[model samples]
Target: MQKLDRAWLDRHPLPSPAIGGDKNARGRVLVVGGAEFVPGALRLTGEAVLRAGAGKLQMATVRAAAMSLAVLMPEAAMIALPADDDGEIASGAIELLGERLANCDTLVLGPGMSASERTEQLVAALLRGASAGQTIVLDAAALTCAGNLGTLVAAHEGRVIMTPHYGEMAYLTGIDAETIANDPVAAAERVAEKFNAIVVLKGARTVLAGAGEEAALFEGGSAGLATSGSGDVLAGVIGGIAARGAVPFTAAGWGVFIHGAAGEHAAKEIAEIGFLARDLLPAIPKLIANFGAG
Candidate 1:
């Protein structure tokens, strides 16, 4: 395993924007997340995308919460997806996302979404609809569909990345969380190879494994990152980096390092264990600049 710290990252820098680049020149990211109860998730994610240096942002969420979330996050162009009875994005909403999905450089899915067969169907449909060149960043409930995706993710080559904490990792591999915690690298590798997607196993020592690639481990994020919606921020960070033209593996590595570093920054400014997920956002752009990256 390789350590995914500053030294390793310095040698593999992310692509920088041109001096006179426009918003579209940076990259476009489409974030499909949030339900009626968790509309703030899209705002957190969309903002993180911009902070990570992605150019344009589009937030797609349940229709019921779209108007309010749009007001909360005026930077992103909002798309209201049809909702099911439970306020989850309906599977049929893919019809509405077709053009956006095709235009986006990266698609960040599954944040704040409920885990259910319906979500799985939605995941599968979106995966199928995504263009060959689009990067897919799957988090939260979207990771649950891995076991059944088979060729769906593999078809993306190295473009699909999944971020899963211990419980979500266990669910993806059918291994108990305890067993996965014992050897997170191996757990991450198993899923990475099985799906042919980059696997980011998030924990105290996050393990990033890609199919046929060396595992990269990071162990520097603050405990405060354990708060609610933290993973959503991490997912958005990765998506934004990917949208900016970083390869999937490079994007995942940078995202992990930046997120952990951001948590440390937040811990110093706020309480080490009491900082909310939103507190980490302000530190992201500064962190990337400090690294001489985008």
Candidate 2:
């Protein structure tokens, strides 16, 4: 596996904005997922994507969480999905999402969503409906909801990127968490080859792999990144980068580095133990600025 060092990151800078370009020039991103009970998850993700330089943002969430999430993230246009009695996004919401899918350059799925049969149905529908050339970043419950991830990802023609922690990776690959933890690069690469999509197996040192590409590893984040909603932030950063035209593997690599760098910044300020996930948001722009400066 190749190590993602500062030099490598500096070489792969994010797309620079044009002098007279409008918001659309940076790229449009749609984040789809958020339940009533976990409204903060998608909100964190949305904010992270904006901070990571996505030009326009849209959020598609459950009806109950829509208004509040909109208030939390005024920058993103909000789309309320139909909800079932349990406050989960209903299967029927697929039609509403289909109407908006073509408008976005990137689709971020699964943050803050509940894992259920309904969620599986929704994921399946979205996967089937996703257009060619649109990037898909899957995280949290979306990873678990898919009944046949390989088939779904293959159907997308390798445009999908999945972010799974050890446990989620176990569920997706049927490899026990312990085995995955022992050698994450191998596990991530195997899953990447099987699914024909980019696989980001998140941990202390994240591993990234995709079909026909060399595996890469990043080791820089602090324990501050272990907090809740942190993975959502990572997903958002990657989605934003992908929306701005980075390929799946490049987006994942850059996202992993930026997340780890932001974690280090947050840890230095608040100390690793007490820093919250939101603390990482403010650090993102500064890191990007430093990248630009270098």
Candidate 3:
């Protein structure tokens, strides 16, 4: 296992900006998530994507909430997907998202989504339809279907990344949460190999693993990061980084490190356990810029 730290980041710099490039040059990110009851979750993810340096953003969510979400997030171009009775994006969204999925440099899935058969179908279809080089970041309910669709995930080669907490990891791997928590690194590696994707096993001490023995560890975050929507921010950060040209493992390692560091920074300003998830957003660009400077 390797420690992911500032020194480690220095050795592996982010992609440098072009001398004269437009927003398109920075890359585009498409974030597909949110339900009527949890539209804010998708907004958080979309904002974090831009905060992490992706230039253009597209947010696809339940059609009912699209207009409101667009007003809340003016930076993102909104794509309203058909919604099921439960307000979840419907399986039919795959057709609406095909061109967007193909066009985006990175696709971030599952923030504020619920688990259901409809969700499973939507997730599977999206996973199967992602373009060859597009980076895919899966989190929350999107992960519930991943374990059953190994071939679809593996089709992307190493271009996919999954962020799952202990419970979510268990859901993806069919292992009990206790066993996974006992040795997360091993469990993360196992999942990564099984799906042929990079796995960010999030917890107090997050473990990022890719196919084979590759693994990186981050333990810098504080308890403040345990709040709701924090994982959404982390997913967006990773997706944005990937959109900007970092490989899956590189983006995961950096995203985990920055996220934890933001937690530590927030803890210093606010109480360790009281800071909101959105509090971590402002620190993101500052952290990235600091690394870019040195």
Worst 10 residues of 3 by lDDT: 211-220
TM-score each candidate. Answer: 0.98, 0.96, 0.97
Residues 1-294, model 2: lDDT tens digits: 688767767666667677788889888999999887887789889998999888999999988889988998899899998888988888889999887888889999999987898888888888888898899998988987763656977777668999999999999889999999999999999888888899999998899898998888888889878989999999999998888778788888888888999999888988987788888998887787686566
Q: What is the C-alpha lDDT of each candidate?
A: 0.90, 0.87, 0.90
For 155-203, candidate 3 gives per-residue lDDT tens digits of: 9998889999999888887899999989999899988998899999999
- What does candidate 1's lDDT look like per residue over 174-283, in tens digits? 89999999999999999999889999999999999999899999989899999998988999999999999999999999999999999999999987999998999999
The candidate 2 region of ten consecutive residues with least summed lDDT is 8-17
What is candidate 1's TM-score against the reference? 0.98
Worst 10 residues of 1 by lDDT: 141-150
